[model samples]
Target: MRTATVSIGVSNRHVHLSPKHLEMLFGKDYSLAEVKDLGQPGQFAAQETVSLVGPKGIVEGVRVLGPIRKSTQVEISRTDSFRLGIKAPVKESGDLAGTPGCMLVGPAGTVSLSEGVIIAVRHIHMSPKEAKQLGYKDCDRVSVLVEGERELCFHSVIVRVHPDFRLEMHIDTDEANASMLATGDQVKILGRTQDALDLVG
Candidate 1:
């Protein structure tokens, strides 16, 4: 069977801010300065960054991505959570229920968030047309095979399809280092669940 391919994008720890939180963190009328465009349409990395304060330690210079979201969220790696002394769940982006909380230090002020930190789950961002071409739907889970010095198969990868998204697979820094994967590396989609295993086997 012909498999779908996606470019890998290793995402470092970043923050997505809500409108209210943005004002509270920055100034009353501050706007994010676009640094670079992301894989997804209209999404960019802002010049702004913030410091995250946790029980055990503080993580500084966490890049803030733009444009602003409806709800604020902090995406960290498993190792970051350990360093911060938070037990953040590996959750899909924007699903912040029952997650840990942390203080975000910005230029204007510091905001204490009740809950929003997460260790982002590995996911593929694709357009609706791309999803249809691959015979997949939003929320469908699949596995990815990355061939390299450290060949690895990533399982339970969530599919997120939207009109605005481009074809890309997002993984944390830790995962990328473990598999010797880097930006621009290609990964093959190996169907869902058992079929995925069969592909690897």
Candidate 2:
């Protein structure tokens, strides 16, 4: 409990747009920023946020993806959600576990795909040095406080200990809002922290 590990979770909104929709928003000035190598098989690993031609909207950053079997997701920060006038819950991306989805109205037409911008939350990978110092393994579960209503505890949050992932907690847009947590909010692992240990679900 001597502050060996300090992890923070940052959540973003995900909205799955259609192929045509993707091109429409970013066809003109879409550029790839970073490609994250997810150890997935046979698929290319790249994430891009496109620049829509606009003084029309107050939003930027488009995360691009290859063809998928399901919906196209657009991740928005809490601030971004407010700017877009999208009334969505600030739940964890995984919190909307088995929900249908939501839609977005663009300048072109209404892009209706899903109901909520929450889905497929993943673990933030960490370096071995960090993991060893924290006494964590590649898939250790940490209890995250679920925001709102009840003082909920999210159990089994996976830890992907590795050298590549930077130290951070990764949550979807939903979680950030429900917890009313913003950028630079301090969070830690839920064990023997005294102040937070008792609240760990």
- Give the per-residue lDDT of model 1 (tens digit) for 33-125: 999998789999999999999999999999999999999999999999989999999999989999989999999998999999999999999
What stretches of model 2 exceed 4 Å from their correct place? 1-9, 15-25, 28-118, 144-153, 191-201
Task: Give the per-residue lDDT of model 2 (tens digit) for 1-201.
Answer: 223334445544334445666555546444333465332222233374443221224454544444332545555554555555554454443354444333444434445544545334435456788777766677666655544443455545677765656666666556666666654555555633234555533
Lowest-sum lDDT 10-residue window in model 1: 192-201
lDDT of 1 at 154: 88
Candidate 1: pairs in clash: none
Q: TM-score each candidate.
A: 0.96, 0.46
Looking at model 1, residue 117 earns an lDDT score of 99
